[model samples]
Target: MIPSAMSATPQSRIEIDPAVVTAAGDFVVPEPLGFGRCLAPVVFLADYQDGQWGRGRLLPYGPLGLDPAAKVLHYAQVVFEGLKAYHVGGSRPMLFRPEMNWRRMNRSAARMMMPALPRDLFMDGLLAVTACSEPYIPRASGRSLYLRPALFATQPTLDPAPSTTFTFMVVASPSEALASGPLRVVVERTGARAVAGGTGDVKVSGNYGAALHATAVAAQSGFDQPLWLDAISHRYIEELSVMNFFAVVDGALHTPELNGTILPGVTRDSILALARLEGLRVHERLMDVDELLQMIRSGRCTEAFACGTAIIVGSIGLIGEHDGRLCPLPEPEGPHAGRLRERLLGIQEGREPDPFAWTHTVAPLDTSAPDRNG
Candidate 1:
């Protein structure tokens, strides 16, 4: 069931479970590559302690031996990141804007009073896991190997201070795009997903946990996701549960500015860059939900979409309120969203030229290569 453990080299700090290649080779790709459902056969793991990071390992994908009183489980000292590895374009897998993810992960760690991840170690984990899972990576146009790198407090202590030890792991999942065509969203007026001066700007574990209740409520109300608002006045539109919000008012793209509450999305940034490069006017300012709805009613806003690592570029067909009032986007699938999604996906999947130099093609580590030790 599980591959064996591994030993690490002092310099590279990368260990390999000899059976990892076999496990990955024997694994089967899922039929309907659901989002993050099919787990790869192997995973990359590392630890942090003694004021420094330890060796990393390529281990079997299995349950972890987490302590019951772990700070992550109690005090919520945890952070995570999501990025993708495309199998198209070349023999080696391609990573889109992974360095941005690394930087953001460290920012989140800093906010949570945790340590920053070294760039080399982070890339090692990503490349190693992606290389090991190459066989199972879906080859379809919109599908990819969804890489989730998570860091958590591992020290077994119930004290109210930070944990002395931490664990980092990178797991791969062969999956399809999170959303397709258009989406139906609900305005979450009562619940605030994130607030200013909080963990809203970072991808910490507690942020998602706090949004679950409202997500459930929105799902029950027949919506795909909830559109979160500012925590204070509840009038300014912050972001969606997992994605950044955007609108096209009078032929110009408008998204809520980064107000220390919204997660700065990688895909959102890429889309903005693409839009600007294509000569589309963009406005990154405080977006009011009521004003956006009014624009939709007055036909001033003709387009709406949300972007994130999961939902690359998802069109918002309609947005509804808690009282069952609905405001449909002027166009269900607008041309702007379609055009932006095409360009973004093109660069991501290697179908088009990467003008921004945003992709990194990962060369698989040779299993047959001799170990560092002679």
Candidate 2:
């Protein structure tokens, strides 16, 4: 049986606008698309006030009205989630590990003192939006409908307390694969994305915003991404700006363990599971930057990659100083990274049997029909 959260209810309601179908038909994707290049014209929205969730409504995508003193605008009390809907080899659109994203969003909200979204409401919002936007989902291998669900405090106050009102929205973009080739990462020795005993493990907006400067500096210096170290010592490797990092050293896959300072990524967990099942040794421990550099210098660390719901598995070709002092990997496209990427994408796209039961299929919405009144 489908979980109750995914089941339709008489009391639950969603309003679909008539413009969605025409927008989907008119949406034009380029011949060779890249990630996050285009957005769908429809969005799903719902409001929470007085401790009750309002009926969700599907409408044409547009800007939102916000008070100048909104808590989210001033205090940065916002959280979000990222997952993908796959259309390859599937009769309907399927989500890859959506429950994990939902759970993570709640974790982030709780950390920020925001109200957690009920499981049913969370699932309903994603399903309703993806169903309405199904026709616009890109139909290509390594491409998908990127789902972004965000929650923000809307109370017009400057108080540090949690807001009495909140807005939850789910928007989508038809995107191609994020990383075209191997990445070149620069070790971030100075800045820290998250602090200890802070919102490091959560998917809050501030976390990404804090990492922007370092990322920008890395980009200007010609590195593809910044590999952040820990906050205190800046010695222990934590993660990338938006993804988790991993390295294959001495035939073993080594990734930074989930310390209080690291985000527990769904793709990172999935990769660990698939690696172990495929008989590759996997280790989750404190990977020190100095130690990794030594390994790279000694030629023990052959390849590295970054994993996330968006990037999937992006191979790391080199790591080092910004002045082109590159620590080149023995194999940029290592066998393990390639094999694992294929296996994970296969499960997500329904090209292979879902042994882990991770994918969830959502039915398409009929835009021509009237709203089902609650």
What is every candidate's alpha-carbon RMSD to the true fold? 4.9, 2.4
lDDT of 1 by residue, 1-374 (tens): 11111213222458887788788878998686789888998888899999999878888788999989989999999999999999876556788888899999999999998999998888889988888787778877889999999999998989999988999999989999888758899988888988779999999999999999998988899999999989999899988888998999989999999989999999989999999999999999988899889989999999899899898999999999989999999888978999999899888888887888887887766665567212
What TM-score does structure 1 among the candidates reach?
0.96
Runs off by more than 4 Å, candidate 1: 1-12, 372-374
| TM-score list, all predictions | 0.96, 0.94
Candidate 1 root-mean-square deviation in Å: 4.9
Cα misplacement distance, residue 251 of candidate 2 (Å): 0.8
Candidate 2 residue pairs in clash (backbone atoms < 3 Å):
none
Task: Note the Cα lDDT for every prediction shown.
Answer: 0.87, 0.84
Q: Native-vs-model 1 lDDT?
A: 0.87
**For model 2, how does the per-residue alpha-carbon lDDT over 63-170 read when each residue is reduced to its tens digit?**
899999999998999999999999887788888888899889999989988888888778777887788778778777899999899999999989888899999999
